[model samples]
Every structure is written in structure tokens, then in C-alpha cells.
Target: MDEIDDSQNPGFPPPSPTKENWRNQYYAYRSPSGEIHYLLLSDFYGHLVKTSEDVIGSRFIKKKLQTATIEDKNEAFKELKPHALALMKDKFGSRVIKSFFEHGLDLQRKGLAEELFGNVYTLSLDQYGCRVIQKALELVDMDQKIKIVRELDNHVNTCLYDDKASHVIRKCVECVPEEHIGVIVSVCVDQIVKLAQHTPGNYILQSILKYCKNTLTQKRVIDGIVSSLVILANNGFGNYVVQCAVEHGKPEDRSKIVEKLAENIVEVSLNRFGSGAIQKCLVFGSHCDRKLILNVILGSTDRNEPLQTIVKGQSGKFVVRTLLKTCDDEQRELILLRIKIHCLEKYLPQED
Candidate 1:
């Protein structure tokens, strides 16, 4: 072909090499606000991909996605689907993924779940990804939730102590459906005592006790804990596990715990942390169990010495107050009589 004057060709224009002209290729003006907004040039999803890389940018995109119309969200989901796993492990991107599950449409959630399904265990073990997995576990449907839990099935015990994974396990225990609750509990039940004593595992144990709904499962877990009552009740973190058992365990289970505490009522009541466990027993324990606790505080020799000692200390006084509220009329009068004999009324304020 003859060398046509290239500038005269209307079909094509020579490329502009100036930086400003290149920059203009990727930015556009908004008519309503008369503001220039950044645009994605090379990559169709470039803007989202860019925002996902920074903390503030990711948060802003999350808010935008939250309020975005269905069509817009669906479009965004298509862009994010391929990189969902990678984003899940990103600090800022993880948050955006979590927000998507929290506020995205069902189809969007399902698309995200597919991205997360087989890799649940790996994500659950990641510091950032674990949070995203937990969020998915909490909000996804039963089938998908089970798939997530199943990934952690054989590894439940290990995850229970992992700093990051433990939180995911706790969420699984607390929010997984009733059918799957047993799956998680069974894996950890045999390790209850060990888990209860661990700083992080203790929390996992508490979640299991607080949320596991099966009667037999609750009893089994409580029995495991009851066997180690004193040790757990004395631990700073484990104490909360013991307290959770008291609050959520069956009456028989609570009674067993109360009886356990009653065996060393004075020592337990004297402890700063154990005192709270004792108070829970009194709060949730059965009629006979409460009586047993009261009798312990009343002192074995009828000297009212134990009662006086508890009422004198700050933490112990709370146990004393719990007793006063739960005790029967006759028992209340007996406790008050002991308080008067010991002159312990100063520890408690007089009624108006």
C-alpha cells in the first residue's frame, strides 16, 4: 500500500506519549458532582483490585458494596470471585470479603462460599483468613456451614489451641447448626479437660458449653469438666469455662458442679477467681445443691466461722450475697442469725 499520510487516516490515531494524556485515559469526570473519579483502564476490575490492596481503600469499597444496587453488587462479585481466596488472606481485603457475606445477596454469598469451601481449614488457620471463614460459617447455609466445619473435623483439637484458629472453632461451636454442633463437640469432648486448662482452649470449651444444645452432649462435656472442677475453677481463663457450665449445663450437671465446689467450699469461696464459680453454682444449682452450699458456708461446727470469713472479704462477700438471695426463708434466717452473731453486718449495707 502507498504510504498514506497517516494523520489523514480517520480509522486510527497515533498514540499520545505524554503522561497527562495517559493519565486521562484512566480517569473520568462525574456530571452530578463535577468531580474526577479514577477508572480502571487495563483491567476490567482494576479499581476494586486496587482498593483491596489498602486498608482505607478496602473499607471504603466495603461501604460502597454494602449500599450498591443488586446489579452493581453482582458485577462486583464476578470481579472478586477469582481472587476471593487471596483476598481472604489479606488484612483489608479480608474485611471486604466478610462484608460481602454479611450484606451481599444470596447468589453473591453462594459464589463466595464456593471460593471458600475446600480451603476452609487452611483459611481457618490463617490470622486474617480465619476471621473471614468464621464470618462465613456464621452466615452461610447448613450445607456450606457443614462443609466448612468438616474441613476442621479431624483438626478440631489442634485448632482449639491455635491463636487464630481457636476463634474460628469457637464460632463453629457457638453458631453451627444443632446437627453439626455434635460433630465439633465430639472431636473436642475427649480433650475437654486439657482444653479447659489451656489459655486459648479454655474459651473454646466455654463456647461449647454455652451453645451445644444436645442434652447428652452437654452432660458429656460437663462431666468431663466436672472431673476437673477445682483446677478449672481456680484458673483465670478456665474459671469462665466453669462459670459457663454452671450457666448453661443441665440441672443435674450444675448440681454435680455445686457438689464438687461444696466439697471444698471454704477454699473455693476464699479464692478470688473461684469465688465467682461458687456464685454461679448458687445461681443455677438445684434446690438441694443450694442448700448444700449454704450448709458449707454455715460452718461444719455451727461456729459460723466460715460464714464470717466469707462476708469479711470483698470477693467472698459477693458469694455471701448470692447465698442470701437464693436461700430459703428458714435458711435465710439462719444465715442472717450467723451474720449477726459474727457482727458481719458492716460488710453489707442495711435495707432502707
Candidate 2:
């Protein structure tokens, strides 16, 4: 044991734990052998209070305290069993009755979930207490039973207070719904573009573009999402934005997007260019859309270049075809020939 300090000692009257303390507690620590160690053994309220400074021993003390609260687990189950059984009376009644089901859930009583959800078709909109109901549902594997619980998890996030719990519940709710179609994606392109002006993450804009690609309707909406994804691609989310470009039905734009992505990824010519997106564009979209990709390749040559290279230092089917299509016969043969020559020199050797 270590020496202990009195409550009257310096740094005494340790600050009480509040939401602010909760945030700061991640970095705080308690003296393991302190006189206040016993206080760690208090109930949930006490655990919250004692969590001011994180201590290894405090967790064991808290767990012991929780266990101590339950006297004769079977008897506890018996006491709460009647109300749990009554939760299946009617939809509204079951929803309301689920609250009393929590005590039995914590005890992990047998057959409790089937007893509660056998009659209810939906979870209560009041999800604050739904956490316990959800835990109980895990024991019952019936489709209808799971569906009701899944529906509850999907919309419960808006009402739940805990962020992690909200995320988890939402994920569970992703189970196949009886009439579920894929998410009906609608992207506010203008909103996404405008938001990206202030936001740092390009993934949001990419997400919009992805929605447009998958939905493949509302041309104006797709254009907006594409433009936003492209514009934000100048930021860091290059691969995702390029994905949106490749997925767009308009075959004409594929090459342009690929070249731009490849250019930025191969070389860091422009400070604003995102290298990761460019690399993916070269690897994935170069072949699918090479006809209109010359602008990106030529753009890389300007002294005022906006990107580093048009190909990601690799040769592939798209790269070979792109080189072959460098210039038509009627154009300046010398200039076109030189471009073809250099491109072949750069790409063909690797393909071989």
C-alpha cells in the first residue's frame, strides 16, 4: 500500500464529476492506494462520481458494487417476471410494458425476449428505454421478432443519448426489411458543393456523387453531385470522387476524370491536387474512358501544371489504348508522333 492523503490536504476537495468532468476524465488518474479507494465501491451514481480520475482498481470496485446490488438473481427474476410476461398484451401496451422488462433483461432470464415481443409489431418511438428491450431480443431469433427490433434500432438513434449506442443500434437495424428496397439516395449537389467550400472532408461530396451514381436518375441532380465530388476531389478524398466519375453513365467524362486523377496521383505538380484520387483514377478508370483523356495528359505538361503526371507510373490496357489514340493522322504528325513515341516509351516497356 502507498501513503494516503487526507481530504484536508493540498488539492483537497477534488472537483466533482459533471459532464465536463466526464470529458476531462479520460486523462485523469487516481492514486490506487488513496483513502478514497473505498468510495469507488459505491453504486452507479458513485461510479460516475469516482470516475473523475481513471484508476485500474476503481473498475473492479465498481463491478463488485453492481454485483452486490443483486441479492439472489433468481428471486430478482421472479419479482420482475410477471410484468415482463405482460408486455406482449398489445402493440402500444407492449411498447409501454417493455420498460418493466429491463430488470429481467439485466438478469438474463430465460425465454424473456419471446415472452415480450411475441405480440408487438413495432418498437416504441420512445427509445430511451429501448436499449434493454434490444438486448433481450438478441436471445430470440425469429424473423418477425428480429424485424420489429431492427426497426426499433433504425429510428432509435434520433432519440438515444449515447453516441456509440446510437451508432450500434442503427447498424443492427440495417437487417433486410420485409419490403426494404435500397436506400433512396438524394443528394443536394449545390448544398454539398457549398458545404465542401468550408468543410475539409471530401468524402461527404463523394458520398453525394455515389448517391447520384447509384440512383442514376434526375440528371441535374447527378450533375450537381458529380461537380461537387469533382470540385472537392481537389481536396483529399480523391479515390471516392473518382469512383463517382467512373460510375456516371456519361461515358464521355470518364477519360477526363481518369486522366486528372492519374496526373495528380503520379506527381504532386499542383499543391491543390489530391494524389490518392489521381492514383485510383489511373488504375481503375483509364481504360474505360480514354478517348477524351488527352486534356488531362497535356494539362500535366504546362509549366503552370495543375497536376504531376497523367498516368500513375504504370502501364495497363487503358494506358496502352490511351497512347495509341494520342493523335489522328491529319494532325501535326511530328508533334503527335513525339507524344505517341514518349507515351509508348513510358508505358510499353512496363506492359511487356
Candidate 3:
């Protein structure tokens, strides 16, 4: 026989049962040649674990699972379940398991959820495993959702800061019910200021504020940020949390942000991130609040030093332009008259 080129795209049906014995199944299977291009659901019979670990093989199984008949899917599940924990952590296997969670039978999901019980926290911290847990949380029943999150109960702070695991915490805040996230929210409440300053933890705080409106928990988080708004706006990372407030918090809450920032307007407008918050005040603050910001921009001292100081800084100059765009015509004229020299320069924006 002529040599069979391994480079050829060779497709192998999933590992088939060996006649030698039941235990011989795993050992009897020999590695097949070439790149796996296509695998049918029925083809996933015995080699499920092997294929689930392969890059192309696992992707094929996931695509097949979506439209495969229930019986074929059950057989694949039987072969895949025992290795579920390991697969959940496997690079490609995790993707296959998530496909099952998304497209497999409801009953099969419960079985996978059982395999994930005590390992949720460890898995949530895994780069691949965290994704599997997130999908399970979305598709599993309430009991499973509670069980999965309960694993992270006291560990909320860790997951909140972890690079991979933080996504799981965010998923919980987004997908789980309010009652189930009390621990997560309570932890955030206690550590609101510190967490808002953390780059990763800030997102968890943002998710709560964005999704949990009207809940007392959201109100407390908002109040916490509002009380510390000035400090947060000045922080390099914490400014994001302050912007979250203007985007998600209530209308009156925004006015409060404008009022609070205006108290330190000159200092804030000169700083980088702090100036961003001032721009938000221009767009989101109400008419009365905009007037407040305009007055601050006009300044109080002889020669209006704050106004001149603001127009010269890089971020502060853009803020001046934004304020001019947002303020009333009368306020704009007063601003234009005071900056008579700047009128000839690019310090001010041209009218559209």
C-alpha cells in the first residue's frame, strides 16, 4: 500500500467501543492521523473526551450539539460527563462543555451542575473554567444558581479583584436575582470606596449600580460614591466609577454630582480624570446645575484667574468648550466677553 499522508485532512468518528473489554475502551483507542475537519454527533460516541480536548475537534462537537438529536446528545453526554471537571478547566474542553450548557438537554445541564458543585470557586478563578461557570449560571435552574454563587459567598472580594474570576462576579451581579447577591452587594457596600479605586473591582461596583436601581442596595452604593465623589473623580481609576454614576444614577443624583464637583471646580478642571467628570456635568446636569457649573467656570477672583487657568490646561480647555456648548446663550456671551484675548486664539470652539 502507498503511504497515507498525515497532512491530509483525516476525519475520525469518535472513539468506538473495543471488543476486548469495557475497561479496554480508553486504552484501545489509538491516536488518529491528520486535522479533524468535521465530526457528527453520532461520531462523538466513544472518543468524546479526546475530541473535546482537541482544538478543531472540540469546536466541531460544539457546533454539532446545537442541532443534534436528543438521543445523540445524551450519548455524547454519557461519555463526556465523567470528565466534566477536568474538561471545565481544559482550554478547548471548556468551550465544548459550555456549548452543552447552551444547547444540550435541560436534564443534562443539571448533571453538569452537579459536577461543578464544590469546585465553583476554584473554577471561577480559572481562565477557562470561569466561562463554564458563567454559562451554567445563566442556563441552570435557581437551585444551581444559588449553589454556584454560594461557592463565592465569602470569596466575593477575591473574585472581584481577580482578572479571570472578576468576570464571574460580574456575571452573578448581572444574571442572578437580587436576593441571591446580598453577600456580594454587602461586601461591596462595606468596601465601596476601596473597591471603586481598584481597576477590576470598580466594574463590579459599576454593574450593581447599573442593574440594581430602585433596590436599596443600589441607593446605598450611589450614596457611598456621591459622598466620596470628589475624591473618586480625582483618582486615576476611580474616575470610571464616578462616570458610572452620571450614566446610571438617578436625575437628582446627577445634580448632586454637579454641585459637589463645582465646589472644587478649578482644581478638578485642571486635572485629567477630574476634568472628565466636569464634562459629564456639562452634558448630564440639569439647567440649574449647568448654571452652577458656568458660574464656577467664570470664576470669582480679580481678573477671573480660574477661567484663565482653566483655558490653558489640556483637558481643562476641552472642558471650557463643552461648557460653552451646554450653557445658555446669555452665559456664552458673558464667557466670550471675559476671554476677549482668547477669542482670536483656538482656546474657544468655533460655532457650527
| TM-score top scorer | 3
- Pairing residues by index, what is the TM-score of model 1? 0.83
Stretches of candidate 1 off by over 4 Å are: 1-45, 181-183, 347-352
lDDT of 3 at 9: 30
- Where's the lowest-lDDT run of ten residues in candidate 1? 9-18
Q: What is the TM-score of each candidate against the true structure?
A: 0.83, 0.36, 0.85
lDDT of 2 by residue, 134-205 (tens): 544443344644544444433432423233233223333333332231221222233445434432223333
1 or 2, which is superior by TM-score?
1
Model 3 TM-score? 0.85
For model 2, give the RMSD to the true fold. 12.5
lDDT of each: 0.78, 0.39, 0.81
Candidate 3 pairs with clashing backbones: 14-43, 15-47
On residues 1-352, what C-alpha lDDT tens digit does candidate 1 reach at each position? 1222223323212222223222322323232334333432222254676566565556556656766777777777878788899999998889989989998999888889989878888888898999998898888887888788878888877788889998988888777776876666787788887888888888887777777677888878888888888988987887889999899877877888898888888778878899999988888888898999998888778677788888887678888988999889999998888888777889963443
lDDT of 3: 0.81
lDDT of 3 at 158: 86
Clashes (backbone N, CA, C under 3 Å), per candidate, total 0, 4, 2
